[model samples]
Target: MIVTSFFSLFISQTVFAKNMYRWIDDKGRIHYSETVLPKDINYRRESLNKAASVKEVVEEAKTKEEQEMEKRLVRLRRDQEKIITRQKVYDNALLNTYHSKADLMMAIKSKMDAFETQNQVVEGNLIRLKQELEAQQKNAAEMDRNAQKVPKKLLDGIKSTQKQIQELHIAINEQKEKQSQIKREDEADIARFLFLTQSLTEKRKGTSIPSIKEANELGLFYCENDRQCNKAWEIARTFVEYYSTTPPDVYNDKLIMNRPPATDTDISLSLSKIPLTDDESQLFLDVHCRESSLGKDLCVSQKVKDIRATFIPYVNDALSRTAQ
Candidate 1:
C-alpha cells in the first residue's frame, strides 16, 4: 500500500514527462526503466530541458519530475525574485531615508502630531459650523411656523449657511479619516524601520539578517506568520463583517444614529442624501454600538468612495503594539 501510494504521488508529480535511462547490457542490449534500479551501472541519465539549474533540481540531481515542474518552478522563482527585489529596494530606501531608526521615529511622530493638530483644528471648525447652521435652521423654522412666506433674504441666508456647513462638515470628516490613515501607516513604517535598522545594525557587526525571507515578510507586513497580527486582522475582519456585510437581524427604522463620540453631526444629513438599504442602515447603527481600536479606525475609513477598504491599518496598529 505504501509503495502504491508512493507511486501515486510520483505519477501525480511526473505525469508531464517520462524518465529515460539508457544502458548497454552484457548481451549488447539497451535497457531503460522509469525508476532507477539498485546497483545500476553504465546507465546514462537524460537531460529534460536546456534551462536547468541547481534550483531546478530535486533531491540532489534533476529528474524527469523536476523537468515537469521546471517551467512552473521558473515562474514561481520569477515571482519570488520580484518580491525579493522589491524588498531590497525598500531596505535601501529605509537606510537612506534617515540617519538612524531614531530619526525615522522622530519624523513619524512629528507627522502624526501634525495630523492630530489638524484634526483638533477641524474639530473646532466643525463646532462653529454646527452652531451657525443651527441658528440659520432655527430662524427658517420659526419663520415657517408663523405661517409667513419664507422671505428671499432669510431663504438666501439659510441656503448660504447650509452650504458652508456641509462643506465644513465634509472637510472635517475627511480630515479625521486622513488622521486615522496616517496613524495606521506610521505604525507600519515604525515596525518596518525597526526591523530594517536592527538587521542592518547586526550586519555591520558580521551577523547577517536573521533570515532574509522572514525579515522580508515582516517588512512587507505579511501577517500570516505573526500571531498578534493575525488576531488583529481577525478583529478587523469581524468589524468589516458586521458593519459592511452582516446586517442586524431586524432593521430599526426608529433607531437613528445621532453620531457616536466621534461626533459626525453631518452624518444624518449625509446619510439622508445617500440611498441606504435596510441592511446598510442596520450596519451603520451596529458600528456605532461597537467599541475597539479597530472599530474606531473603521469609523473614519468607511466612506462612499471605499465601502470595503482592507483593514491593514488595524493590523499594523496591532503589530506595532506587540512586543519583541
Candidate 2:
C-alpha cells in the first residue's frame, strides 16, 4: 500500500508540472507563467489558484517578436502624429506671413526667378539627350531597313549601329531620371523657402500698424485725407511688400491732389496741413487703387486727368464720412 501511494503521488506531481504558474504583481494585477514565481517576490500566494485561470496569463507572456512588433506600432502612430503637426505648422506659416498681396507676389516672383535659372540647365541636358537618342534611332532604323539588301561585308556595320542605338536609349533614360530627381529636389527647396518666407512675413505683421483706424488716430496719413488716407496707406504697404519695392509712378500718381504747381515756399504756407507731394500721392495710388476710374493706366495724361477729376469729388465726399 505504501508503494502504491508513492506511485500515485509521483503521477500527481507530473500532471501539475504541465500546468502554468500564477501570481499577482506589485500593482495588484494577476500574472501567470509556465515557470514558477521567484521566491524574492513579495506577493502572497493565492489559495484559489487554478491551472485553467492561469492559462490566460501564460498566453499573454509575449515572445520577443511580438514585443518588437508592438513597439514598432506605437512608434508608427507617434511618427504619424508628428508628421501631421509639422504639415499644419507649415500651412499656418504660409497663411499668417503673407499679410498683403504685394508680399505674396514678391515671394512668388523670387521663387520663379530661382526656378527658371535652374530649369535652364536641366532643359539643356534634356535637349542634348533627346537629340542623341533621335540620331541613334534614325541610324538604327536605316541599318535595319538596309540589312536585307546589304552584303555580308556590311553586316558588322549594321551590328555596330544596333549597339549604338542601345547605348543611346540607356543614356536618354539616365538623363531623364536625373532630370526628374533634380525637379523633385528643386520643388522641395522651393516649398521650404516659401514656408520660411511666410513665417517671417507673419511675424513682421505683428510689428506693423494694425489697421487703418489705428493709423489715423496716430496721424500717419500717406495719401488722401484723414482715415481714408490711413486705410490707403495700409493697402499701399501690402503692395510695396509684394512688389519688393515702391510700385511704379503710374500707380502712385493717382493719389495726388490737383494743385497748380506750387513752389517749395507755397507748399509750406499751412502749419497744420502737411502738403502731399505728387510723388507721394502717386505712391499711395499705386499701392491702394481698388476703385480708381483709370484702373492700372491712371498714370497716363488722359487717365490722370480723368482720375483727378473723379477723385477730388470722392475725397471731399470721404471727408464728410470720416467725421461721422
Candidate 3:
C-alpha cells in the first residue's frame, strides 16, 4: 500500500507541472502552480519562453523567415538606389556639355540683326553725303565755267559755295574715322561672342565625360567634371561683361542712328531718308563710303561727284541747303 500511494503522488505532481497556472497576489508578487488559485487572485495566461515552451519553436521559424524577407527587400532597395544615382550622374554630364542648339541659333540671329541695323545707319549717312558733295561740285563747276560772265554779288556767292565745299570735305573724313573705329570695336565683340558659342557646340560634339576628380574637388552641384564647371563659369562671366553692356533683347532691336554733331545737315538728312536692306555686303560698302568720303581732306570734289553717281536719288535736290 505504501509503494502504490507513493507512485500515485508522483504521477499527480507530473500532471500538475505539465498544466501550470500563473497568478498575482494583492501584494503584486507573481505565483505559479498547477491547481486553480482563489477567486481573489487575478490570474493571467503565461507566454512560452524559448527554453520552456513548444510554441517557441513555431515562433522562431516565423521570425527567421520574416528576417530573411526584410534583408532581401533592403538589398533590392539599395540596388535600385545605386542605379538611379548612376543614371543621374550621366544625365548631368550630358547637360554640362551643351546649351540647347535652338538657343545658340537664336543668339546668332540676334547678332545678325544688330550687325544689319548698324550697317544700315552707316549706309544712310553715306548716301546723303554723296548727294550734297555732288551738288557742291556742280555749283563750283558752274561758277568756274561762267566766272567772268557772273555779277559781283553772284561772284561772292560762288566763293562762299566753294568755302562750304571745303568744310564739308573735312567733316566727311572725320565721320569715316569714327565709323572705322566703331567697326573695329564691334568686330571684336562679335568674335568673342562667336568663340563662346562655338565652344559650346564643340563640347557637345565630343563624347568625353566629366572628370570625377574635378567634381570631387569643386564640390559643386551638377559638376560631373572640372571642365564643365570651368566652362559654366566662363559663360557666366562673358554674359555678365558683354551682355550687360548691350542686353540681348536691346541689341536685337533695330538700331537707332544718332548722327554726329559735326555731320553736314544735308548729308545727315539725306542718309536718314534712305531705307536699309538685308544684304550685308552692300550695306557695309555704303557705310564705308559714306563715313569715309565725308572725312576725306583731299579731293572732296572728286569724292562728292563719285558718291553722287553711285546713288543718284540722294542728289535729286542737290543744291537745296535745307536737306528735306
The numbered model that scores best in TM-score is 1
The top-ranked prediction according to lDDT is 1
lDDT tens digits by residue: candidate 3, 1-324? 786578546544553435554445557664444555456333444533323342311121235777899899999999999999986675454345435545545655675677667667656655665666566556657877987344576556656655665665665566667666766755554544444544454377562222334322222123223443343333323322321222222111122122322432122211111112221101111111224544443224554344433332222223123234
lDDT of each: 0.52, 0.47, 0.42
Model 3 is weakest, by summed lDDT over 10 consecutive residues, at 279-288
Residue-level error in angstroms, candidate 3, position 151: 13
For candidate 2, the lDDT comes to 0.47
Q: What residue pairs are clashing in model 2? A: 97-202, 102-242, 103-242, 251-286, 252-282, 252-283, 252-286, 253-282
How close is every model to the real structure, measured as TM-score?
A: 0.44, 0.26, 0.21
Q: What is the lDDT of residue 211 in candidate 3?
A: 35
Q: What is the C-alpha RMSD of each candidate to the true structure, in Å?
A: 22.7, 25.0, 35.3
The true-versus-predicted C-alpha distance at residue 136 of model 1, in Å, is: 0.9
Can you list the residue pairs that collide in candidate 1?
none
In angstroms, what RMSD does candidate 3 have relative to the true structure? 35.3
Clashes of 2: 8
Between candidates 1 and 2, the TM-score winner: 1
> What is residue 301's positional error in candidate 2, in angstroms?
63
